[model samples]
Target: MEFHHLFSFYLTIITLTTISLFHSSKAVNPIILPIFKDTTKPQYYTTFLLGTPSLSVSLAIDLSSPWSWFTCNLVGFNDTWYSGVPNSSTYRVQRCTDDNSCAVYDSNYCYTCNSPNCKPKGNMCTGEIYPPSLYTGGSFYGGHLLAPLLLDIITVYKSNGPIPLGKRVYGFSFGCTGVDDLKGLSRYTKGVLSLARKDSNSFHGFITKAFKIPNKFALCLPSASKSTLNGAMYFGGGPYKLPPSKLDLSQFFVKTALVVNPIDVGETYGKRNSSIEYFVNIKSILVDDTPLKINSSLLVIDKNGLGGTKINPIYPYTTLHTNIYNALVDAFTTKAATMNITRVGQVSSFSACFSSKNMVGTKTGPKVPIISLKLDGRNEDIWRFYGFNSMIKVSNDVRCLAIVDGGLSVKASIVIGGKQMEDSLVEFDLESSKLRVMSSLLRFGTSCSQFRGA
Candidate 1:
């Protein structure tokens, strides 16, 4: 498929609103990325400028995994079609020996001298590594780092002006894959921006420190049916500052605490903390006002720190435990029976579906029950998904519940996916240890026009 450049503007320094009191204005703005969906694949793509004379390349937005890389010719990946190297004087590699940041060095697919068939000829640094990540619902990534981690001037364009890495631009370390054992980078995209935690020098880490903002980021993904490939992601709170309008932007937000990982497990990410993933504690789930009768213990974080539900963008549909799924299906089907919404043959794997002929052509469908999530033991802090989002029209005549069952893996209980998050601004606040969900009603324009200060 052809890639299109959706956003084109220079970045500028904006007064940091969410930073500590000591620091003031910083070169910060939400690097707005134009989102494009792959009709065939259940994924979305965005573009970013990687080097000095900025080479624009498409990147898949993945939150479950970390470690982002692009194919490099020097690493022996010449056969692959990679967005060529950023020919700039400022570009350099972060050597393992010279730097002591182990957080940046560790990866499951890390290529060291000890790795099989990877014998370093001489004094080559073994620090440069790439970790293989296995997604629960998508492609299983397995690959090695061909060369040392690279650091260069990564530029992001915004409305105010070009917010280049001013004087503090030491560049960030990214992977350069040389080996070809895993699926090709082209299969996904030119590269991936694994939005999960990495070292202090990684993309999101660097931005948090550089701008002196809380270690948090937010994304507003539009509905799938919307024709325009429009969405917004903010590194800091810079882009979330909507201009004065009639709508109270703050009214849309629902706040909750992060599930506490076991003390022994730690938040080290790639290592023992793999089980942490992006799991969030679910206090309860309610259909309309009535709560579902599933075991609440299923939401507790396990010893491996892998309990509760993960609000993962990688999975297109929300998944629930078999017990919880059955409860939901029964509740929904019972509700449908009262509304006279005839059950059609199953669409996809979702068991609860209605005949499309009755409601597909019409703008309205049977009343969909409101689904609400009570977060982190807070009864009032609820994130609700309306009827329109809970049911999706797969074919012209078949409308199915967007949620699916996780089969028998009771441990992998729930995964709140993209469909539930559409038209909502979801924030992963690492510093505050909270997750905030903002309804789409706060969005003022199609492309965050007000966020650009337009």
Candidate 2:
């Protein structure tokens, strides 16, 4: 298949200044990455500048994925979309007999194969690493880090911006896989910008330590309806000041402890905590102030490493386990009737959809019964989903609840997807082990677009 999407995803970094390579930075400046909302799909992406000459490669945002990976030197893919890896002089495959092979780093599950006589010395090994497949709803990722100047295009909308790190930040780590890893990927995105918490080795952990910045990052996904406006990601730490008010958006944050589920007895995510995922404690779920009648145990991780809720930015919508979903759908449908919003046949994947003609539209989309996630916190610590966050407009006549059913047998009972997160400022504070969130940025009279390129 011809994989090109026929649209220009030529990054929007406002300006690309000549970066001073090998420069060490210890100044207190958080990095701002311009996260883009894909026009062709329901996804957000950020650009990665790699190779000696520098290439602004677009990668989709994957919150739980351990390492960053992309298609390199691949065939039948867009030239600009995939890495022009072979063209880089510094590109070196990690030798199997050396620092990178499975024998060396067992935590990442790196593997190698002998090329010729099967002797370790005579064989040419590709130090390949396997990433979690479930996060992307795809097969296991067979993809490494090394090569050239993995320079970042610095974006600072404020007076004080990200200061480039010394020599160490020059070499960013990632993997290069084949086309099969392209599952759950849009044609516009080359690969994933994995914000996985794989410590020091993963991009998030590496950048935080290398830059001497705080081990925290902020994510603000722009609305898909506002395709022109870019989303934003604040790496390092924050004071994420956006325009109009230029207020430090961080001040509005309300947080809950970020938990880590233990590794599976079986094969959940082998030796996880290395391939770790971000989980939040879901105490209960409510539709318009009424809690759903579902077993709360399904929302917690079990001894078998099953159940729990995760923040999945790449997924199009928040997903619930079957029982929870059924209860939610029933509650929402009943609530919609009270508001005179009559039900329509299910629109797309949404189990509970309503007629747009009966729905009341507001600045933040149509008014719907708010879906509140009562996380493990004080009674006031309810993360409410407003109209825009709870409903999706499939057509002029139909509006659907953005949440879906992830089937009975699923890893995370509540997978918080992209749709529910739009215009919401989410801060992942690794240092504090807490997820501080500011939901529905528009409700605050500010959109992420206050910063140019979003």
Candidate 3:
């Protein structure tokens, strides 16, 4: 008994008991032992009794080899002892015979319990573990009124009708006088002018005053001597001057020597009948080369050459009437065109005269033009101008007289077969009661000149 001898004796006893128990159990059930024999040892006492005779101990102990154990533990082990290892830390395992090298097992294996978490080789893990909702596709991220000014212009253009050549004439005059001041006004003025040039149906208002050619004049009177006719004569035309008080150099101009013509007349009380006519000979300066056709409605003024050099009284009155008449005409024409009606007939001769009065009386005059119209397939159709009190009546069957006041109001009465059939104010204010007087004066064969002075 020494301690070393005792320890060896105990180990020998344990091994002998284990062998005996294994041998005894072999008769009932084969007991396989996991052990490897040293091939270098001699046969008798030198050979280690590593396993049973019929059982292959090497197979069970294969995994115990240094190389095998190292691979098993390094790759990933199922044993619970490695569960506490931190994913961030590395662990070293024993080397195996197959590859006598120690390997490190990182958190990857620890997270997956070291099973197949350790891939020997092949295939890769890609993509985020937790992706955003729209990660698969790109993130989605919304649209203003372009050309606001242009849009405004279009809106105004759509709402209104074409401008008249006469207005262009006035515009040119104004532009010329204050060429330096009216620089930017061209944009809007040009837009208005474009309509006049492009559209054929545009109309303008004109003023007329009655002048009687003397009855004593001979038929061969010379053109220069025509002024000698002492009879009262009506001369109406315009390149009406704008009142200096209300004139805005940026907004308006004047035209000189515009011409007005007599188309017809309406009866007054007993003997007076107002004259009606279209204003022709309006001189429009060429600004944009837009074409203008004859019979196009126009606004004209007498341009009587009154008022101070810098200030004109007749201009403002004429301008006010023209603006109202123009607006009214446009409204009616546009509405009629929209309705597909072809003819917007003659303006009410009476109302035209009244409107003229209002124009001279106030700055904000009537803005609607009264027109008399005869549509196809219809006779005696009277329509109130869309934006004005003016009425247009058709009378192809009989001669009709239309009269317009100096301010632009109109009155029309029909005379058929030498008998005045209908007398009416082709235009009238809502509050006016004088239309009744005009109605009574319409009699057959009534002379239009008798009522012209009204």
Candidate 4:
């Protein structure tokens, strides 16, 4: 029997799926790779080749992270690390004084010490600490790694063959990560890949320098049911950008100006460090084409001035602010009232549930409503979420609204998560600072590999 990647639909929804970016090869066109989601491990991974000889390492992709690190000579786990050492001539450590080192991560600057050990005035490798990252199961933790950054070759596989992008930096001031504590990490985690900002020696930045393509990337995460890479990711340029006459699914693809979330710079650093958070303003959300009845201000940016909504691939369920959450539940409940379904009790972390007589059947479920998001206050710039994206099938006879409450700890009003993003191609154009959402794959009924992106 095939090992099915199935879990209790309810518990799996709350499980954390942390995404980190790894540096990828740059070519004339976008390099395509298969993303593997393991339901047993509750993890997402993609394979990449690294080092001079090029070895395959399945790494977790995290866009919010700036560090690209893999375990080397790691002990006490049934895992694969980089093993021994690479040729120092090609994969070497970067000095703290190197301009490229500091340029990769401004926070990597070791102000107090001159060296790896933080000597009073010695030159050495820089150390950095990451901000606390949240996993929806009620926990937050931070990790740190100390290593000298290095510029090396990384090869990625496309339909043709292996292609290498040279002189690309492995930032966080290190070629290989040192002994560190990665708390709350998935057991299948071999390394962390980062698609950091352009100025930060990021993977996309390397693509821009090597391929001369726009500093942008697009990704589509497949549904949890499929274990294979039904989804796709494109670097270099958008997968879809056709003319008006050629427009089909292109019309459904909504593009909106990206919003920057202001981060507090440390008083000691004197430099603003950025993260991979795709922050954007959500003007409003609609269920069944009716705008939700909530305070417009609540739907705007946060009190701290960060964008009110962030499209986080790591978070599995869509988390909403308490006020906005209440409004959505009320509205969705009213919409369900019209159907013959009856409101069921809550399931695990979910807010609402429903049950119907026909729901016990294999394919029968509620007449799920359509949910849409208005971006940057533009009515035209809307991203719609269908019934499957907004709701979850908890049991054979029970289905639940997949939304979760962000609670008081969360700053953002809404977090558009993986559940809403599955089966849809979302592009993040760093050059134009815009986000494009499309349902073309479903509209055209084409596989990701066959898309022939423009």
Candidate 5:
């Protein structure tokens, strides 16, 4: 049989078989041929499978906005408003209307800005008579323009330190394609300022012209994933370090800003739609890093019962692990030294054709053995160790196989002599903190004729 055909067959049986059989016996019978009696000899060497586990998918978000005096001022007013009410004053300042549009009388019988518009129309008309002209109804003027007045409130509130009204308050929400877009928005303030100041007729131009100066105060929202910017914060420009004053901006933005989490963004944008698959095959087998030189052949048998065969001498690395390669050098050297097969002419290869169920947990095929051995020798006595039941009967020889999963340890076994052997099971338990070895064995006999029918 050709080597490829033999390897293919081996992979097929193991992948298709799930049921495993275990048998233990002490009887020395005709089929119980033994090549070596020394149990102290080690048969296989160990090596580890190196690879990292796959990473899960994830996402990130960024945001930005405009800074105006109106915003700062509104923040300041709200602070004062909240502070004016004493904590001991338990009475909930209930408004006569749902919108808190009821007036409150102060020490001098002066009415507060409880009305919606503060204009003397309808419910806003206060007939109270203290500080007469103070009833002009402009008390709640700041409340009327609350949203746009935030910029000014913030400016005053910060300049004079914490006001009794609490901290200035502001809020905003928006969406973008990804981190880049978010950064773009954050840096957009500079461009907006430049454009507004450059023109004479634009609204910004009116402010610039009236103030006789450009608005240096720029508003910006913080962005996430600053590391992606490579030690620099990315805004409108490629990358930039935020100014000292803007450093605290991130805190405010993080506190009150509403950003779309990465997971949600991925779902809405359809970015999480990719996957990958993998497959692995063992081309050659070695014991203790030694390559077993076998004069092996291949045989292909199809479901139709038709088969063909090919012959070839298995060299160290031909289709599998090469002898010259450091990986299999020790195994080949050890096997060759122990078998005493010095010359290439001393080895004769044979092919065996047997069908078994591919092995489970194996991706290649079904009812197959987890591990297999091939020998190139004439004396059935020498190759006896490679026979069907030899692996099950021998305890020390089974340590040649290794099974691994997710960097964790798992138990793996192979069928031998028509029965399964627990001692034949191999364990692969290499963690980043620790390492282990994986090895297998092969036995060869003297006289090339003994391997002719294998």
Candidate 6:
């Protein structure tokens, strides 16, 4: 396999074994969502169109998050981003009256089955309510605090190559939340767009089966500075072509089996279910081709379901466990010294930083040491991070190593964040349990912002 180029998946995955949507096929056109990197929340978000008249809502993207919730009329609270509940014939709190699973969920809280609506499920609704999200990232929008599970009509814009065609889908499952639960989220976005695994309970899963499409998606996250206004996301079927050269980005993809982390990373992991988060088996990590001294045990999943490496785009930077972090920073600092790259004062969350005066810029990014992640491939496939993704600029005079110490209590030893993912293609095949990754695309003279972008 070539050592250069990159590919991976999020909600938008390029089809490697593409199935055409013929007139006689059961397939529909795949939905294309333009992804935006919001400086407000310092996170990525996408526009979600929902309901009868179609409310264009902003939603933050969280790959591991289970609920795709938004601020609707949980109470009388009003806003432009909130769902227009009054005139919406399809916007209603999904009642548990017909669901035996809901009744078995919390029999103590179960009541006489009756009518339900946009009314908050506190004391007003008479059926069993789905459990609220964990208090940390849970929901509460109205005076009524039950956080009713909501079923609404959602609009997915199908891709006709670079252009989009709208398709309205019913039976979309999500949570009805309020502004109070919006803490840590962008002030502009109403809710989160979860790209969790395609199990029976997730948003991605519902849409895949509902649309009769494949359970795979791809992501090409863009920086959008001097590039296109946004990035590209494809939900299903694709002949993912980029203009000018019409390069197939998926041709660069190398497949690896995705492992499941048996425990959630949340504080409430014990009370809830095991995490559906995506994890990859990283055999080892290297700096400048010389392997860093790391505990091999930390690279493997322990019996308690801790250790291993996780892929989470919710956070913007890569985080490492303390021991591995210490080893990496030391090795990187030593390698920098060999290159005569002067170190400066430490910045918050980053231990190693340098003065920009001594650095030279190149087409790829700043000239720096390469970081490599060795994955268990047939002939040893390794994902390399060059100058751009490896080093983050903190100030005009300073740039720091783009990795953070994730403390000792974390589940995954290495949590891959979004910053390192920019300008790359990623695809996840839930049906095959495989993760397709192309580490970087800059060398190809094209970035993600230029491919299928807004």
Better of 3 and 6 by TM-score: 6
Which tens-of-lDDT digit does each residue in 1-454 have in candidate 1?
A: 2323323222112211112111113424443444444444455555555565545555656664445565544322221223433455466644443224434455323223334333221122232233333344332232334444556665543334423232334555566554352332324355555676444434567666655656777776645423233455666642244434434354567888766455212223334434334567788888876788998877776765545777766567788878888998887777666666678778667788876454422222235666788887556788877655588878876788888887765445787877777656687878777788865433344222123211
Q: Which candidate is the best by lDDT?
A: 6
Q: How well is each residue in 1-454 modelled by candidate 5, as lDDT tens digits? A: 2332233223222311211111112111101000101012111110001011111111111010111111111111212122232111111221233223422311111224434432221221111111101111122111111111111111001111111111221111111111221122112110111111112212222233333332211111111111111111011111111222122221211011111112211101112121000001122334533334432221112232111111111001012212112233334334434543221211112111122211122212122222333212111101112222211111221212111111111000111110111111111111111101111111111110111111
All candidates' lDDT scores? 0.54, 0.63, 0.17, 0.54, 0.17, 0.63
- Writing each residue's lDDT as its tens digit, candidate 2 over 1-454 gives 1222212123243421212101113325556565767655677787645564444467788876555667754422222223332555444443444434433322333233333432222222332333334344522222333211122222222214333321314546556566566666766666777686556446677677666678887888877534344666766666565555556676777779998877532123334442267888989899999999999899888876678888867877888889999999999989989999898897666768888887777766688888899878777777889998998778888888888887877766888988888888888989889988887778767776544322
Error of 2 at 351 (Å): 2.2
Return the TM-score for candidate 3, rounded to 2 decimals.
0.14
Alpha-carbon lDDT of model 4:
0.54
Listed in order, each prediction's TM-score against the native is 0.75, 0.82, 0.14, 0.75, 0.13, 0.81
Clashing pairs in 2: 23-166, 24-166, 144-174, 144-175
RMSD of each: 6.4, 5.8, 51.7, 7.9, 34.8, 7.8
Off by over 4 Å in 6: 1-28, 74-87, 98-100, 103-146, 225-228, 237-239, 265-273, 451-454
Task: Output the better candidate (1/2) by TM-score.
Answer: 2
Span of ten consecutive residues with least summed lDDT in model 6: 1-10
Give the winner by TM-score: 1 or 6: 6
Candidate 4 lDDT tens digits, 250-296: 34678887776666211112334443466777777888888898888
Error of 5 at 159 (Å): 82
Quote the positional error of residue 46 for candidate 4 in Å: 1.9
